[model samples]
Every structure is written in C-alpha cells, then in structure tokens.
Target: MVDAAITPPSDVDTLAAGGEHCSAHEATGHHGYAGDAQALQNRLRRIEGQVRGIQRLIDEDTYCIDVLTQVSAVKSALDRVAMLLLEDHLSHCVVGAAEAAATSGDATEVNEKVREAAVAIERLVKS
Candidate 1:
C-alpha cells in the first residue's frame, strides 16, 4: 500500500498540518479499512438502532428487568463489533506493520501501530 505521492518526512509533517494523523500509516497507506466495509456499516447501523430502541424504552419507563436485558444485548452486540474490528486490525494492519518492519527496518512504525491498538483494547476493556 505504498503511496507514490508520499513526501519526505519533513515535507509530510508540513503538508499534513491541521490533519488528523498520528501514525505513519497515513503517509505509507500501510493501515487501512479492511474486509467487508458494507457488512461493517450494516452491523453499526443495527447497533445504532438498538441503542435508539433502548433510549425509547427508557423514555417509556419500561420495566427494569426488560431495560437491563436490552442493555445486555447492546453490550454483547458492541463486543462482537469490537472483536470483528480487532480481528481485521490484527490480520491486516498489525501484520502489515510487523512485516514491513522485518523487511525494511521500520520497527518504529510497527511499535507505533501496536501501541495504538493496545490503547484501543484498553479503552474497550474499560468500556
């Protein structure tokens, strides 16, 4: 996924000013959205609907147990989404970064990607 348009590091730093980029992937195109984009969108839509339903139930003063059940379902659905995203990230971005590091002495990029993923996992666990 190397980008021919990629500038030198300093040039990139200047060019990318005001853009959201913390990882080398932004320039290298090494990390990207992977696998079944439509499916991911569908899953997210379902989860979004589920959340709205929960809000409706709360508004209508649904029974405590029923609300709790919906809450549990939402949590499970969200967990599944997280796992799916994690799988894609591991199989694609993380692996790509590591391979690039091994072949091209870009271990810093791999380390950065891993650290980013670790932080995401930590946030998910906290949630």
Candidate 2:
C-alpha cells in the first residue's frame, strides 16, 4: 500500500489538472441541497461563535486549562464536521462516480476516487 502521508506525484498531477474529470460529477449540486447546506452552515456558525468565545476567553485572561478544553472541543467539533463531509462525499460523489464508470466501462476515474478516499481515511486515522 502507498504511504498515505505522502501523496504520489501522479496523484498531485491528477489533482492539479483542475480535477476536471472528478469535479464534473457530484450529487450535492453546486450549491448543495437546502437541508444539508443549512445544517452545515449552522454547524459552521456555531464553530465561528466558539472561536469568538476563545478570543474573549483570552482577552479576559481566563484559566489556561479552561481555554485549552474549549480548544479541544472546537477541534473535536471540526473533526465531526469533516466526518460529515466525508460521508456525504462518499455517498454522493464516490457512489455516483462508480456507477457512471461501471456504465461507461471506464473504471480509471472511479479507481482514482477510491484511492483518494483511502488516503483520506488514512489521514483521518492518523489525526
């Protein structure tokens, strides 16, 4: 297996090539569905507020451990958000790409997506 920490040159090239083949198909729609978008936005808003709170905590000279605890919470929350996004991507993007490739008899694109997903999962595990 390839080392997930080190992205291959070909993978970099494929990604840099505008990701055109990968970008053209997605179920989330460019703007995403109303419900999912709104939910994500709300989470982001809460995260933003958390960040502001951290700032205020610093300004008020709050206890170090309390601030660090809040920071850890923020990290965990952000990780949850990332997991959600990854779930969405797999369900919508990866599935659709696989189906399309199967129908077209072109497995290369879908294989790349699978590799990308594997790398992502590895990174998540490491983190």
* Best candidate according to TM-score: 2
Clashing pairs in model 1, backbone N/Cα/C closer than 3 A: none
TM-score, cand. 2 vs. native:
0.74
The alpha-carbon RMSD values of the candidates against the true structure, listed in the order shown, are 8.2, 5.5
What C-alpha lDDT do the candidate models reach, one value each? 0.66, 0.67
Number of the predicted model whose lDDT against the real structure is largest: 2
lDDT of 2 at 84: 84
The per-residue C-alpha lDDT of model 1 at residue 123 equals 63
Off by over 4 Å in 2: 1-35, 122-127
Q: After superposition, how far is residue 110 of candidate 2 from its true place, in Å?
A: 0.9
Cα error, residue 6 of model 2, in Å, equals 16
